[model samples]
Target: MSQQARIDVISGAYGRANRKIEFPKNASGKHESMSDIFGTNVFSIKKMAKSLPKPVFENFRQQLKGGHTLDKVTADAIAHAAKVWALEHNATHFTHWFQPLNDTTAEKHDSFLSLKTTFDNGLAEISALETFSGSELCQSEPDASSFPSGGMRTTFEARGYTVWDTKSPMFIQDGPHGTRVLYVPSVFISYNGEALDEKTVLLRSSSVISKAALDILNLIEPASEDHPRAQNIYTTLGTEQEYFLVDRGLYALRPDLKTTGRTLIGSLPARHQQLEDHYFGKIPTRVLAAMSEVELELAKLGVPIKTRHNEVAPCQFEAAPIFEEAMLAVDHNLITMDVMHRVAHKYKLKCLFHEKPFKGVNGSGKHCNWSLSTDRGENLLSPSSTPETNYRFLLFLVAVLKGVMDHGDLLRTTAASSSNDHRLGAQEAPPAIISVFLGSELTEVLDAIEENRAVDRAVAGTTTTQMRVQGTTLDLKVATLPKLNRDMTDRNRTSPFAFTGNKFEFRAVGSKQSPAFPVTVLNSAVASALLEIKEDLLKQMGDKAVASEEDILAVIRKYITLTKKVRFEGDNYAEEWVKEAEKRGLPNIVKSPEAFKRILAPNNAEMLTRLGVFTQAELESRFHIMNEKYAKEIIIEAQTLWGLLVQHVLPAAFSYRRELSESAAALKQIGAEAAPEMKWLAQLSPLCSDLEDISEELDQLLNEQAPIEDPEKAAEHACYKISPAIEKARELCDKVERLVADKYWPLPKYHEMFSTL
Candidate 1:
């Protein structure tokens, strides 16, 4: 049948009027005392200091801030204090929370309900010291087999250990039913010492970056009379989270959405984002209430969510927190996602973070804003005015350029995902190609350094930097330098990595993904690059008797020349860019499996291992894990399509065709012209035929159980085989939708689902 006829039938399928529900304006304001309720459940530093002995508290603080190893005695004392604080906050249960191979946080809660007997032979109480200990905090065993271990463990080997992560602090989370719970962030590992969790690798990567940063700082500013107080380097990050909030009633009616967290089959709604009024328009009353509740909940947990705004898409919105330590930022982002879902339910909304939840519209992404900072509170990525500032900025900037250039494949791997594949390279999102967008100001600096031109320090806001392409000047202007207060260049949505003032916003992260993997990759890659720069600088300055400042500047200039290929100032989505990127030798890894395969390459593994981010085994495990995830996702999607076709679409098509045939026969018996009914039957006949053919093919594919021996091949088949089946099914279902009568159609139409909101 024609596509238009099928669409018309599907459009008339749903006749019932949707029930409208009103949301409370002050649903989030139930707990009015913000300060009193905020962090009341948390075992915070303030709570710790108050609960523990002065000496024990001081020792534990040193361990947390200085990264010192806590002796067994100190660990015991710390645990005792933590138990007291948790109990005081009404936390009856404690959980060792960790991020496992699934890339989502997990926890196994244990109630503090030890059996106790008093002298009078009655059950009594246990002291705080008796309740908590180092051994208990150090390790825990959860069911490992239930998680995706990538063939690392079997059902019989259900042993997984959670080890305390001394760096991240313990906190409390408030859940439904007024339960206050204590949460300890930790790392999960197997019996053989293989890293079995995302947190373990991320923590290791952070340590590597911190060390490398310190080394670079020391090399640039050696300990001398003038240059004293060199300290540890730290990384800062902020994550911009985008999500869609649909009415819960509409969401519940859609089986595909209920199962897959996205729509599997739905034609475009006429008013969906096409009007463009929803982008930064007045927030809908229901959505605003939902956002308010989410914000209030997150703030109580100390998430520091500073910005909330309407995103480009219709029902989509974005929230961002103030920059914090990179690891903490990652934790906050995870917590925020959880909070969003929880509060969404309270406001009768469903928050969708799937990258492309709705096709034919903008997808969501988590823009990871990353930067480097010195212990002395200076942002290393921020450019300075004086020669000293300029030299330091250029040096760090070049380090980043070199990092991205050398590990472009790794960067691509960092963002590879099945959901993201549909978003990337589209006009509204970043392209698959990895390149750095250093605005006109910094681009000129790199060009000048490459050609040994005198550094331009004049206040000429519009000075043009000339290029030597057949004596053709590129007319690159040093436009009015945005002030420190206004440092961010205009955001380029199409650029995968863009410099936004003091940090690089990695815009390629899929919305549903945990930022841990990509952030860890970024930290590890930059650390390795900085280590190389430090070594090269040391080699070049040996016994030169040159000024330290001048030598540092010279080294930065040299580094710029070597790492300039990664920088771009124009549209990354342009066809011209595809050709230019190829000429520059950048890897354009378009598929998740292919991109993930790079993780196990010899050099990539070597670099990661050297930086202590991952062992060779750990790296191989991740490669297996990502490929397995991709394959499984495709399999699930394919299975969903198969079910929808067999149980829903095909049956509905046949039933509709039978009704059309009966109606045409009735008209002919009445001795009346049945042209309209005949035409309808003609359309229904072809649709029924097409649906049968597609359904048969889908059944054959499912029954054949195509040989998928390896994860990569399985994922490839999913992309090529399973995805097309889904597309074909959707096309047939949409066609049948337009022909079938409203009472006969089983699923809700797009107009009823989207327009009702």
Candidate 2:
């Protein structure tokens, strides 16, 4: 808090202000067209065709297209082809790219060069040769003890394996060290076959849901007009990723962004999104430059990211991709974050994916647009033009509603995290309460079905070709302007689970967390629900002569009546909805830690087990893992806040107080009015004491119960006790920021961060 220290902060601010930015260009002398560079780096089916034999390439493409497995002979052939492709791209090594329990991706590279005993010149010696085999390409062994296992793996049982997931293609990763490695998408698991990674559970759930959906589709004949009865179903996903960009220099100055991925103590800036100017505003030159590089790299990797734009908050932006298979989408999103981080450094910017990097502005969310589709190109969720398809759509819709109503807590739990605690239900994001928003027309149709009454709207209100009457759309209402068309389903930004025109947008998911778990849990719950509905329809048939269509319709009607409570068409953020939700017996999970208990609930566990998504043991391990992660994150934040306040903020506050005191004494000696200095000291003096008191309280909070033996209870204690204390300390420190001289404020203010962009 010395004057010189304050001067250092001022100097840094000026230095940042004078910094000039230059945008880097592609090395090809001219910008490549999207068609020219798209998927160029990927070892795609086309690339496989070029590098592999006719029979081997056809077999590999068949396996990828239809979820079939290749034999060892074919695997060896494919591995040779992949090696040739990677080597052509300057790759010397290959790595199994996997997502661990932590927030990031993990990889361990192994060179293709292998040492072998050879007899050269009649002498036995080890000679190195570039080698690759089916076995080596198929699997990898890595130590799992250091990763978060939550008692799933012990120190003695450190053996784990990563098996190649052929469903997703392998691509070459060009690194900062000028080394290119062939990255094979893989799933990690323990030796005992327990799921140790997010992808394992996701893959299992995909199988379960595909089977469940196929069963339901089989219930109705003439499934697709062009193809036979659907053999397989896939979950389609388009994840919109939001993030913030800070200058690398300023990001280094703030230790919180480095350690926590969020600004722990910055105050709200005066000009942050209040004028509604930044949302969809023109992109900054440097940010656009970085984004262009990110897109180009991702396109080469075949991610197909299609959109990028300024977001609701200053320095915050979003990028989204076209929909892909659920599994591929998850992998693409994980790698997209990595690519963004790396590409951002080229422009001297650090990407912030934290849920709430700055307070008082809108936080980021990974709005997952999800739906179901058949292998024959039939979208199960889309509104059908014919009555037959429309009826099938209603059946699936009712089934999903039942699923969300029954397992709302579990679905909500998937998006829970310590960082998300700062975003949920804050007027910018969806409420913690899970509810379905089916536009006005669809709501009416469902009500009519439940009540056996005639609907005011058409039966298929969501279809583009409305069979009965006119539908709503956007109208500019100007003589010279063109009429803007609208989607069949209206968008409800306030709802956590909204039924968009073609897919459901889960808007509650945090920006930083991977989408694998969220997609897995949701699909699992829906599969369970669909299975239950199928059984109910079969049960209604009994030994009677009732038509199968009648039985299906009866089940749909019953479901509409059962899940009516979860269907809300009004404002979910209002207080009245909260009261109404409680009255209707809906679970409102406000805290992130509270979600773990839901995962432990008997019904939730039983449902997941029955659907083959997770065993009870796996579920318990995951629960423990989440609890430990939440508790540990809070503890670190608390510790970091203590150090930042004690070392920087309080010292700066006290130094300003000292200067005021000295000036007040000088005025008294000169017989001048010392009243202003005395008043300033009075205001600034107590802040020093209050900050010290809060810092002591925070330290005691950490020391008294640093690691509670029970992971669940420790998470609860942190949620109820430790986190609040940290916030209280931050509150005092923020107050000191306002009272201290602007020149002496040590930490970067929000204004400075938003100044450039």
On lDDT, the candidate that comes out on top is 2
Model 2 C-alpha RMSD vs. true structure (Å) is 3.2
Worst 10 residues of 1 by lDDT: 466-475
The reply for model 2, stretches above 4 Å from the true place, is 1-31, 58-69, 223-226, 385-389, 458-470, 473-475, 541-548
Q: Which ten residues in a row have the lowest lDDT in candidate 2?
A: 16-25
Residues 1-757 of candidate 2: C-alpha lDDT, one tens digit per residue: 3445434544554454322422234687666677677787888877778778898877877887565688788889889888888888899999999999987899999999989998989999998888778888899999988787889899999999999998888999888778899999999998898888999999999999999988877765544566577777999999999999977766777777788888778778678899999999999877887888888888888889899999999999999999999999999999899999998887777899999998889999999999999998878887553323276788788878988999999988998999998999999899999999988767777777778776654554544444321244556879798766555556789999998876889999999999999999889989988998878866887864332777777888899899999999899999999999999999999998998789988989999988878888889999999999999999889888888988889888888899999999999999999999999998888888888998998888888667578889889988999988988887887788888888777666788778654
Residue-level lDDT tens digits of model 1 in 1-757: 2334434433442332322433223456653554554655456788778877898788888887775767788788778888877777677888898888775789988887675544445756554433877778777888777776777777888887888887677888877787878788888888677788878788888888888888777666656777664566778999999998876666766678877777778777667777777778777666776777777777667778888888887778999989988888888899999989987777666889889877778899999999998777889887654322377777888888888888878988988988888889877788989999976556666666666775453321223353211211233355575423223245677889988767899999988888988889888888988898888778777975333876786788787878778888789988999899999898888878778888987778889988878888778778888888887887777677777777777777677778877887888899878788778878888887887787788777656535676877777777777778878878877877777776666666666555433
- In candidate 2, list every pair of residues with a backbone clash: 1-651
Query: After best superposition, candidate 2 residue 481: deviation in angstroms?
Result: 2.8
Candidate 1's C-alpha runs over 4 A off are 1-38, 65-67, 118-130, 223-227, 386-389, 455-488, 544-547, 705-707
Candidates' TM-scores?
0.89, 0.94
Per-candidate local distance difference test: 0.77, 0.85
lDDT of 2 at 440: 73
